[model samples]
Target: MKMPFFTSFILLVLITQIAIRRTSYKIESKEADFWEKERKANFTRKKPLDNLNYIKIPLDSLPFGKLDDDESRYCEKVIRSLADQKVVNLTGFTNTDLKLEYGAPNITELTKYDQNYTTLVTNLQKWGKLLYDAELYNEATTVLEFATDTGTDVTATYKLLTDLYQNKLTLSDSEKKEKISALLPVAEELRSLSKDQIKRLLTESL
Candidate 1:
């Protein structure tokens, strides 16, 4: 026996309502659980941070960053200041990870250390561009290469390096291609939101 159309429609509505309620319940439960865990994490005990890797800038090597210009001099000053700072690239790590490893209390310090590296990479890109803009191709290459090799998540560093390799540098076509190819993994490994832009820059620039 076929049910009436109105009866069928009412049944469908009931089923849809039930499904919506269930989904809403699950979402609420998940959100509640996440906050509970986060609350607990805030009280986590302190832990040693010795296992964390820190970045130490090598100032003696990068002598090609500045020339007879104010911009380059200012850039060098920023770079030199970072040499003694507590710098680290905590790119992929989250607040939860930091709390778990270094404890909640140390999160502020760890964040500041990461910020130092952020400052360093930002200055590195700026310095490299300053050199390039000054027509110091070799000097720009030195600075940009250092930034790239340091695993900087700053996309500008990668862009400047790509520009150097593809256009500015005296390397042959094959050499240029090889250097550009090397940056592919570096781009893929970046934790920056601008990584796609860097990847596109690499591909289209060549």
Candidate 2:
């Protein structure tokens, strides 16, 4: 038997309410769990961070002056400011993880380390793009390679490298494929939201 139109509408509304309630419950559950973990995190003691792998910026090796535009010069200045800075690629780790790893007291210093890493990676991407835009293919690759080696999770960095290997750089067919193939593990290990996109791009390119 066919249900009346009003009866069908009411049934649909009821189903929707049930789904909304379930979703709200899940959200509340997760929030409660996170808070409980955070409370534990506060009690964590300081851990040694002396063994961190710090990234060093190769300022002299990178192509820094092909373009004299305002943006290019600004990026160079920013990069130079980081010459003496400490950079560590802790991209996949979260705040809670940091607190747990190095204790709450050391979070401040750890945060700075990560901030420098982020700053360097971001500027590297911009600098590389600027170089690529100005037809500085080899120079762009140098910048991009440094970012890649430092474990940047930025998808654009991977994309730029892929483009250069395939079309821009003067590499043999096997060499091009080989270089791109090496990026798979790096992309696969990414915890960034863009991980899937980077993986997909690399997979298809290979």
Candidate 3:
């Protein structure tokens, strides 16, 4: 038996719609899987101290940031003090990265000026992870953005924050592209700088 023309047309339309839906679902699923892989990779590495240029501040009778106590607590206090602030101005400290290179504070009297660059990065990572777990991507982004200014050692924080912005935040493709382009140079610049150079750039930015 021959089908009527309208019936055949309707059947073709339904088949096309099903195919479109399946294709769309497959594309969305692939994207989700890729993002998931990226997110999981962040946890595979050690936290902030891994790739940073920090010297562990000694706990030799220093009233603040005693290392024997909770390291995270010490970092948390440092981070809070830096809230709503941009990169730390190196001018605040006596320029001594040159002199301190020879003898570490363990022997020399440089303990008073040894900078704990890792602490802020560590705290930022913790806070960003907390905010992300709580589904506060915007807040996480804000915290991570502040961390970026503090130093380039915030690779982990920056990585996770970018993931949140890309996957969780609602942004157009063009806007996302623009942001990534702008951020890549900063990351590269930070990576290239020595500890002293980073301090100089950060202080000059202020």
Candidate 4:
């Protein structure tokens, strides 16, 4: 039995729509399954910090197995002195006393010690800036170089050094231009700093 033309066309359209709907449903299901699996995998993975066994060690005990007996003894004495000062208010002994008692070197002696001393870097950077502000360019350059070479913001140090060479000291105009050109990259990186900070740095450096 042959159907009417209109009925035949209607049936063909309905079949095409159903087939498209089925294919779309399958694609959506696959995407949903993929995302669900990804979420599960992510949840199962260990976090980076959680997997770090070194963090389990005490902060004072970090970089373990790196220190020798003398270094370890010096570190312990320093820690003890700090703790005593904080807990017992024992402030009679000067830093020199502590160094003598621990047989540890003083600042000058320890200048050649491990370059990773955060406190030393802080002090040197502070002193460097003070000297720079006092118009002592040579001394400031030496201190700042020590601080920056030992890993305290090399970019800032370079910028300051360049400024000192350009504006503060007696460099020739050609030399000043050369130094400024050399420091352009460092300045670009530090351009994100506040205008006030940039001005303060330039003022001290010059």
Candidate 5:
């Protein structure tokens, strides 16, 4: 016997819905699998250094001698052991070695290192501000000549430097007045500023 028209229509709709649900489920499963694989690959490719402990040694504390091979090997072993245990503090060893190596009543090597870094940063800040104010953008690049690595404020410094170079030729008296006029609104919005902030604003204007 032939099926009634309404029954056929309902069966056809049920089949179509089932097919659509199956297709959707397959697509979702494929996406889930792809993301899982990507996650696993990223985990596998992570740097070993990220999980390893690093030993910071003052330059003076490093044992210097072509013949002290055994001592050097021992130090390397100690560093490896600390890395394995994820204990990064090596200040005790570094301090002891500093005394042994320097043999003088003076500032520790680590203190000197810190002072040098502080001096560099201070000089960079001063020079950067002066160059920004003087509109001597080309000369300002010298401030970052020794920058070996990027840091929090370093990118901003670089950006300001680039802007300075791009706008160096445009700093004639009339142009200066025009540029200052344009920046007035921004200065109003940011009413208070440190020396560095003012330098940044001027550099960015370039």
Candidate 6:
């Protein structure tokens, strides 16, 4: 004898329910596996500080390196005299792309009035890197802003600063507002300069 219509209907409904449950379980398992892999990958990535290998060099290399023996001796004396001056430690900045300017020595005497813009830009960049390495991202951004204000073409620097700011979960609302306020003038200065003038400034400084 044929099965009753209601019995056939019940069997069909139970089969559909079982199939739907299996599909849901499979999707859940796949999602769980994806999250686990992402977590492990993030944990294994290298720390930023460990990757930086900063090397300190004289602010003006050619001027110092080309000195005659006697002049070199005099320069050395000057350097020794100013040795106690404090300079920001840039030990966390990578040396790659820093071919021209690296960190400055702790010697204030070497800096003079009417300093070149490169010197100014280099110092600002170093300070920024030092601050970033120390986890003072807001301060780092401020210093890099100074570099941008001086027409240093700090697009890459700004991008990096933006990344740091976005990831800075520890900062309070007031602190972030203060940083933005400080950056406004620098942004205005950058906007005021013509592209040619910025290039000229860089050329003269270099």
Among the numbered candidates, top TM-score falls to 2
Ranking of all predicted structures according to TM-score, beginning with the best and ending with the worst: 2, 1, 3, 4, 6, 5
* Model 6 quality (TM-score): 0.29
Tens digits of per-residue lDDT, candidate 4, 34-133, equal 6675455444422222221110112252222232355444543443333222111112333333343333333233232322243444445554555676
The list of candidate 3 runs beyond 4 A from truth reads 1-78, 81-97, 100-114, 191-206
- lDDT of all predictions, in order shown? 0.82, 0.89, 0.52, 0.48, 0.43, 0.46
TM-score of every candidate relative to the true structure: 0.81, 0.86, 0.44, 0.31, 0.27, 0.29
- Pairwise TM-score winner, candidates 2 and 6: 2
TM-score of candidate 3 relative to the true fold: 0.44
In model 4, the Cα lDDT at residue 108 comes to 32
Which of the two, 1 or 3, has more TM-score? Answer: 1
The Cα error of candidate 6 at residue 147, in Å, is 4.7
Over the stretch 20-134, how does candidate 5's per-residue lDDT look in tens digits? 9999999999999866754444344222234322333222432222123454344334423332332232222333333333332322434454344434334444445455566
Question: Which model, 3 or 4, shows the larger lDDT?
Answer: 3
lDDT at 160, model 6: 49
In TM-score terms, candidate 2 sits at: 0.86
Q: How do the residues 73-114 of candidate 1 rate in per-residue lDDT, one tens digit apiece?
A: 887898788887788888878887788777899999999988
List all candidate RMSDs to the true structure. Answer: 3.5, 2.5, 18.4, 19.6, 19.9, 19.4
Tens digit of per-residue lDDT, candidate 6, span 16-99: 999999999999999998667545544442332333322233444212223235534454444333333322233222232121
Q: Which residue pairs show backbone clashes in model 6?
A: none
lDDT score, candidate 5: 0.43
The full ranking of all candidates by lDDT, starting with the best, is 2, 1, 3, 4, 6, 5
Give lDDT for model 4. 0.48
Candidate 2 per-residue lDDT over residues 26-87, each given as its tens digit? 99999999988887778899888888888878878988788999988888888888889877
Model 5 scores worst on lDDT over the 10 consecutive residues at 145-154
